[model samples]
Target: MKHPSQNSSPSLDNVYRIYWLLVALFVGRMGDLYVLLSRRASTLRTYAGDTSLPGGKRDPQDHNIELTARREAFEEIGLPLDPQKVPLLCILEPFLAGNSLIVTPVVVLILDNTLRPILNTPEVTSLFSHPLISFLHSEPPFATEPEMLEMKYHTYDDVSSSTRPGKVRLHRFMTGRETGGTKPIFGLTAAILIRVATIGYARAPDFEVNAPGQPSQEQRIARALKHDPIFREAAALEGIDPGRIPEPSALRRQVRTRDKRRARSKL
Candidate 1:
């Protein structure tokens, strides 16, 4: 008997090709079960010590953003994500790194826990999984320099307003120190966490979620800007003033509103 979930008679002609090539954001559960990989050499750390989802830059060969994420996971952590195991849940804003690399994140649902992952020693030192709920726990603030950069956004006056107003936002990236002086997750990891928090909050019910000893998001961001090494490096690299980035909270709010509207449409 054919499984009902499998579309055996998939047709290309009926497929609607929406060329919406915007940066895609997604969320993935670390399988429903909690498991942690043994840490190899504690001394060797390159954003590989902590437990995290497997992901990386999108390769040019990927047919779509989803393919890019799946490929990277397989290569870095040795998890062969079956196509059937992943479902597209949401899209997030694009995150730009200091080096100008644009990242698109995709969230996936891991249906089973029996699959063992073979960690790539060169890329990943260990592998582990924790309940998504643990992310709510608070941790002490770590110290690091805050990063200042400019961000651009469009503002709409009203629902009926046709003209879109473009403005610059002063944005800040929190350093590892602000969290509790523990080794900070910065660069791509930090950016990924921001997107994850936004998506998680959107999907969660109205309730209070807190991290222990960690400062509020706003405060952490301020501290990051104060200690951001990139901001200083940029100044020396270009010999130009590394001013503060623009605040995109208004734009983020608009995006979240749009997400809610789309969610309503799905019902």
Candidate 2:
């Protein structure tokens, strides 16, 4: 018998030298896609308070991104998924961080979700899950209003005693959380989920059914840019025009004017 786990698949190398990373978007049998995110512990340096997905730099012994994703999931949150049932559905485009790291998101449908995560307190304080659809909705929950996420970072050279501005990006969008989940997902994660929803479901995951009132193509895009701060750079990395990036204010206008809709996105 050929075990599915041993089957070959594409993945980012685990040499540990490549800046590549992997995140798990685990979907359960009930069709509820869960984003396994971790809250950085107080001791961490970067993104100490911000919530991000569960995955990290690969161990040199890890074979591929799939192994890296699973290994990271367990190490961070104790999500022990069976390799036989959990298959990588697709690998989203690599995202570039402000620090120049390329991160890839690996989607896996978990046949089971009973395992509990053992928290690595120094690295991750806790972990949580939110339905994937929360990020797709257009109204009060996800895209209620236009919000600006202007991130300004600076780097200091210890030797020269000089400071230089790092990445300057503005993220404008609505909050994509519901219930008690106040922690919104990072911008790049939202981009990956949007692609997954459109490709796999043929519709945005914002709701159970698509209707006339749903966000138009332009509006949906505007929302995505708002969530992801570095999407523009990511697109440029793929050889797309940076001008295709939409403005945050324009997206706000579209969302506010629900009575009118654009037939197609301008950008």
Best by lDDT: 2
lDDT, candidate 2, at 36: 63
Worst 10 residues of 1 by lDDT: 152-161
TM-score of model 2 relative to the true fold?
0.53
* Worst lDDT 10-window in candidate 2: 152-161
lDDT of candidate 1 over 130-236, digit per residue (tens) = 33332222331222233312211111111111221222122222222223323223334433544455455545312223323323334333323333554344333
Error of 2 at 214 (Å): 24
The TM-scores, one per candidate, come to 0.43, 0.53
The regions of model 2 sitting more than 4 angstroms off are 1-31, 140-182, 204-267
Clash count of each predicted structure: 35, 4
Candidate 2 structure quality by residue, lDDT tens digits, 101-124: 456777776655565679888888
In terms of TM-score, the best-performing candidate is 2
